[model samples]
Target: MTTEASGTSPLNHPEPAARTLRYSAFTHDPAGGNPAGVVLDASRLDEAAMLALAAEVGYSETAFVTGADEQARRFRVRYFSPLAEVAFCGHATVALAVALAERLGPGEIVLDTPAGEIPVATRVDDEGAVLATLTSVPTRSRPASDTELDATLAALGWSRGDLDPELPPHVAFGGNDHLVLAAASRTRLAKLDYDFEGLAEVMRRYGWTTVHLVWRESPELFHARDPFPVGGVVEDPATGAAAAAFGGYLRAVGLVTSPARISVRQGEDMGRPGDLLIDVDPHGTRTRVTGGAVPIAEAGGPRRS
Candidate 1:
């Protein structure tokens, strides 16, 4: 069951599977950006079943709609990586929102996740594509310990000199925790070769969902890459949670003025380029991440163990 990417890994547990939809988030094209599995209705599934289904789907993460309030357009959603459950996932959230908008009509929806209540707004673009904007929960960030930062750099084969001294390294949290490391140059960020096992160990120990590797291209433009070993993925193409966390990191370090919109370009090195738009409000603590999603395919079958 294990692939060459990881040795001797366990397969997804066998379970009665539910119908799942596949979509690519953060890109208008179905072939671009990050792909996510969305279970529009998962009320009948339990946590173990959800986890198994997520592994079967084999995406970076899958989103499950556990509860729904049709009258208010509110839902209880849960996110599960292949290996375990995550508090929240931005791209999946966007995908789900767009999916729902297509059915329920573009508007606002409330998602109650383990992390907190997230407000998502949906709109139809001029081209008739559904776009979603998710406002993250209150965010906070703090400096990473010197020891932890050093170990992480070693795992990524990065050094202090390669880092953007002004940005530094910090553990930032939007809904999920991510270690934010700003590279001094785009070239440094592009050449990503990390010890998967080592980085995974460090992330698990620190409760980090991903390592947000970023390089500022301009005052409001950035290039980002996320190492998501904790999710059993080599990298994430468009990480909304990490982008939100990075927005928080920028605010924490006084790198960005408030009420600003930032653009993040990701997945180019991996050959699936995508764009994520982040909005920071000077009056609010939450950051908003916006993107579009398109259906890729549909799947429904029992997962083999």
Candidate 2:
């Protein structure tokens, strides 16, 4: 493994650091999707250093891979945010899958992540990016108590009336926990405002990764946003973990029944539009999330000298 100053490495410093990571998760379009930072080799960076680097890069989450030789395909992985390390991250996984596909040619890759072992299948499409699908760990869902739900609603300045009747309130876990809240109207989903510090405090106390705010646009599609105050971010335009958790939520609550596939269109409201696919099985333990990613730019490409 090799290390360079933040943004100075061959992969990161062609012009801006964003070019180094080759993924636009949740969408096939390279220009219209969630961007994630993926480092194929992270052995050179320690935990604190990785966290600092992630903070500097400022993506919602960055994936670091360690303990894998060049000859091997598997990697030990971890994810970090600006403030701390997390148990799992979906977008980063998609980004890593694309990066691996770029290097090893399109194929299936297995990652030993902090949350669990995730298997990803990758292939390139006419859109000119490597598409990857990650099967998440077994999912679990539980209804939030009235008190907990009240505190959550208060943090978002939302009332019980704003919630969708079809999807009830629940805390869903794919890898980490998310409070799933469905908005009754598309207008409510568009108008996103929340208590920053207040919500952060509550989220930290409850060990929540994000608040999944969604409005179903159609039976197979939805508009989504995530409040990640716990990670010190106000919102995430595209969230893979929340998407996986939502699939579990839908199945557990009978919203989608069993053996359903759905697409989530996110980041549109934020202008960095991305799309994600979710596959749920009535009997299978894992849920699959799929999307495409591209190298933001070429390594050693032209730069402003």
Question: What is candidate 1's local distance difference test score?
Answer: 0.87
Error of model 1, residue 185, in angstroms:
1.1
Worst 10 residues of 2 by lDDT: 296-305
Which residue runs does candidate 1 get wrong by more than 4 Å? 1-17, 298-305
Clashing pairs in 2: 22-295, 24-293, 26-275, 32-273
What overall lDDT goes with each candidate model?
A: 0.87, 0.79
Angstrom error at residue 49, model 1: 0.9
TM-score of each: 0.91, 0.88
Clashing pairs in 1: none
- For candidate 1, write residues 113-219 as lDDT tens digits: 99999999999999998999999999999999998899899999999999998888999999999999999998999999999899999999989999999999898
TM-score of 2: 0.88
Listed per candidate, the RMSD to the true structure in angstroms reads 8.1, 5.2
